[model samples]
Target chain A: MSHEPRDNPAQHREQREPEELHTPIGWPLLVVFLGIIAWGAFYYFHDLLSATGATSEAGDRRSVVVVDPTAKADGAAVYAGNCAACHQATGMGLPGAFPPLAGSEWVLASKDIPIQILLHGMSGPITVKGSLYAGVMPAFAQLEDAEIAAVLTHVRKSWGNAAAEITADDIASGRKAFADKSTPWSEAELKDKVGAP
Target chain B: MSLSIAFLLAMTFLISVGGLALLVWALANDQFGMGQQAAETIFAPGEVGEVEDPATPSAARAVMQNARKAAHQASDSEELFERTIADQSSRMPVLFWLSSSMVWLLLGSVFGVIASIKLHLPDWLVQEAVLTFGRIRPAHLNVVAYGWASMAGVGVGLWLIPRLFKTALVGGHYAIAGGLIWNAGLIFGTAAILAGLSDGLEWLEFPWQTDIALVIGGALAAVPLILTLIKKRVGHLYVSAWYLIAALVWFPMLFVTANIPNLFVGVDQAMLNWWFAHNVLGLWMTPLGLAAAYYFIPKIIGKPIRSYGLSLIGFWALALFYSQVGLHHLIGGPVPTWAVTISIVHSVMMVIPVIAVAVNHHMTMLGSFRLMLYSPTLRFVVLGAMMYTFASVQGSMEALRSVNTITHFTHYTVAHAHMGLYGFLSFVLFGSVYFILPRLLDWEWPHAWAISLHFWLVFVGWGIYFWPLTLGGWLQGLAMLDPARSFMESVS
Candidate 1:
């Protein structure tokens, strides 16, 4: 059958007789396929070996350092992990629940106040910047003295509150003093023991 | 902070000014002067051993001269036809790339189906960690994006660029090598991801070890087209060629820039990730798809595009605007407000190019509507073009803060994404395959019924896939906004 000639010159030129070229599955493709297979095998085995190696290394390392838990705590890191959720990253804590540590009289007063709070926990209505916040601050008693000191130091120094650094020795003393207190302390009890802000 | 801001502003200013200067230099140098002659070169009569015209002094003499000229023209046509046939036949590399893409498409579909099913029945494939939903979802995305879309796009470019340049493809071996290496990379990358070795970045999940293969593969694949462009017979760069070349250039840069590990940290890393992710759609897939649509729509209909000026506007505007628009993905996130605002502004500016392309395509298809019923190529191409306009405009709207407030973290974004990737890009690729395969293989498709059935099934399926998700997402957003609505209620 004869086809009609196209009006456009480019279209007319494009209407060419069909010709097929025989392109067999060549050697390059085969070589590449083999190469891929080899690479995949290597990658899979390497990943498995490395994963096992890491776990074994971790296991070997853990046994030696099981009892020594005096690792230096990064103040910023401790605050981000433990304190940021309720007090907030800016230290402008949630209204009517968690009190803001930023420029709070209690935070700036003394290192012993925060050290006691970290080791023993705190509860009841606490007035900060004229707003009363009543919430339970869980005792991070499981944390090492160094971590407790670091977090207390972080909160005091942060959010425009200028205060003295809290040391691990101070945290140790605070924990020793609060050893018999099983329950969280009220605002009045904390103030009475640590001195009024 | 102020100093850094000033430095950034200066850098932006310098880049813009430098780009403008280069454009001006090109314009003044007459680089684009031979438009009409270049456009006609592809169709000009082939050489017939330099046949000389005899001076016609009488009627008989004129008739004899005319007859001789006709004989020469006919032989020239025959020679041109043979050359074209040889050109079409020499595309084995493209076929290789396309065939590999098909395999990936099937693989991706399997992953997608499994992932979708797991959403409802999580325990179905819970035995193996590799077959988990988290692994399967990324694998599906990677297979579709890199394996199917990218490979198929390269295949089309390899064929289309040479045709536009009116030259035989130069580096067939390079393209084949690239395709093979690319497939190897995909195999390794997907395996790694399934084995829980993912880098944990969306769209950039391929482990660094395997990603290097993709970079090398992409560079190799791009060589042939770059060679074709350098050796082009015509002076005028067609709009399709502009898009094709830009895409080839943009992709490697985007890929390399995004994959540089430890170069950015924290919020900066998120910014770069979104930048790379969005541009993969905008700069890479969108350009290739649009280029195919632009070339096929006019070529099939036997007409030039409606407006050359509009095509240029669309191409340049897209290049300029689309780059900055990716930051809109991080709206309301930790990134600077100025960056997000700039992205939103650029996203809206995208409408300029979208409309330009829309008008050009719309006017071209205005008188050729009847062809869609008869031509499968036209049917898919036209529909894809329309969807491109729709999806891009919807994307611009979604980038707006008002609309984004509702659409963020909702299934509406997912629906929008499918509309762009599947409805626009994939549909265009399907049309391109249908149009190109016959020419490349020198054989007509075996079944018209099958083609029609495939089209309907996908078309209806896509409609079903997109609409409910879009509506449900909007409802979900509204429910989320209302304090009275519970999370469970909204989810249900």
Candidate 2:
């Protein structure tokens, strides 16, 4: 029996049973586990605390319930949702990439000029506050007249711009005035239609 | 829906509390006192410190021979019985499961490549409704996930259990029948998906009727494994056996629990979808891969695992952490803040298991790294093990709110999914198959170089496949985030 080889398949003891080295779970793992737990508990409670303070129980009903078209649009909310991405929430847009809406001559020119610019998007080079900006601003034609007017009113009131508030009636008239315009307007094209301020 | 979230949250909380209680009990009772003695459980009488693999030197083999012969003085009849059990268990069922799984793998890969190609060239296969990207994509996913990956897992798992128990498979016929039914169900389900009769959920594209087949088939397959465990000749179960047995139970439970008809609706349905989808990877595929790695890595290299305690930590932490991670898939979705937050934390907590497993495997393989050069199984399994660490840690990071916000809808997610499922799980399965097939069939792999070629091709191919998509997807996410970039620009 002592002479028999351990490699034969027919033998029940052909292979050794798998063993384990006597390594201990050292302090590093303990530290990591405790650290993660502490962080998780902190994060969880922090989220709950901040969420409670910041949000009402109503809690983002924008998606859950249907909006009433007759309800007055919140100008600031509209601006935050649509325009704030490009034109900063501060209304001071990205330098070179986007033009600032804060105290812009184009925005404060005539109410008609800003309304037309928004209804039909701008392309090619356009100057805002003496800086030349070349980019595309997508048309907000899909927006309701009230939403368009509300966002425009928001920009006008914000960022030290003392322009008068634009009404939904102004947006409606602007849409009708440029109903045939399918393509975006260039800076030259906009100047040709409504003279520069 | 809130009820569902509350239920899941409570369940996670209960598991954490229960785990903590168990830890306290262990500490109080000194359960972890005998770390060295616990590590010795895997060794039989004279097997301790014995190198029993083919790579062992002739002098070492002689020493092993003397030790084993002295320790295990079995009679001639006992040896015959052992041989008989080994030969009998490696019969019809394993072959059927493995061969069919290979066939499905080939088919699934073809479908996947076609779907991928169509993403760039939409008009390429648009003529056939079945070949359109929408139909083909889900078809590919379902086929690979259920038909190929699951079947391979069952085959290898079934084969390993009998060996671990030192007994013949208790109900081999049931596994065969189950394999047939499972294949039939997969075929019907895939055809139905191509014919536009899908359920329209990501992993649940197979209709309810087909899901019934899957549940029944899975139950049938599990019978033999459970019975084998019950009828075992071995006194103590190994860590690998634990993983395999747990998987057999976990998969069936997950499949049945998630597949109950009309069980969830609207937001709850989305939650359930991700829960099941993620757990399929976590509980089902992951256990099988880890079990294979735990067994083969030590067996091939002629070494014990690094630490028995770490293995226990890895297993328990995985159970407690992984189950909660499903909700991380809904991180930025319409789910409750607390629920997603818990999931994110759990996802991060997964680092515990990943690190534990990593240390054990790495330390075990420390001196035997050169074995990968000669053993195809070692190469594939080791790479898979390493990727498990990589994929898991990456997944943990990806679950963070800050990271998920960018990568959620992008191809980055797709790349990450493949790293885990394909690079980790599939590679492990491939290695297991390489090792198991030769033993089961009583024949060596005809071409070792061919196996090496296959490895390199996949290794290189996966690198080519993964990096671009990950980088491109990250850039895509960035572009989508930037207000200056157009929608079409991001698409391009």
Number of the predicted model whose DockQ against the real structure is largest = 2
Best by the lDDT measure: 2
Off by over 4 Å in 1: A1-197, B1-38, B45-86
The 10 consecutive residues of candidate 2 chain A with the worst lDDT sum are A1-10
Compute the interface RMSD for candidate 2.
6.4
lDDT by residue (tens digit), candidate 2, B1-492: 244554556567556746944763574455766555654553444442233333333344455455334434433444335434754674578888889999999999999999999988989989878889999999999999998899998988888877778677888899999998999899999999999999998898998899888888888889998888898877656778878888888888888878888999988998888888998998889999999999888876666788776777788878877877888888767777777877888888888888989999999999678666666677889999999999999999999999987888899999998999889989999888876665556554566567778889998988988899899889888888776679778779
B1-492, model 1: which lDDT tens digit per residue?
243553464354335334533543443453545354544554555433211111111232234334334434332554355345334534688899899999999999899999988967879998999999999999999999999999898888887876777667777789899988999999999999999999899999999878899999999998888887787766666788889999989999999999888889899999999999999999999999998988877755544577555575578768876888898899778776556765676677677678778877887777667656666667788999999999999999998888998898888998999899899988988888876775566455666667778788889989998999999999988887776678777777
* Candidate 2 chain B minimal-lDDT segment of 10 residues: B48-57
lDDT of 1 by residue, A87-194 (tens): 899999988878888998888887778777777788878888998887889989899888888888888888787799988898788878768889887899988877
Which docking class does model 2 fall in? incorrect
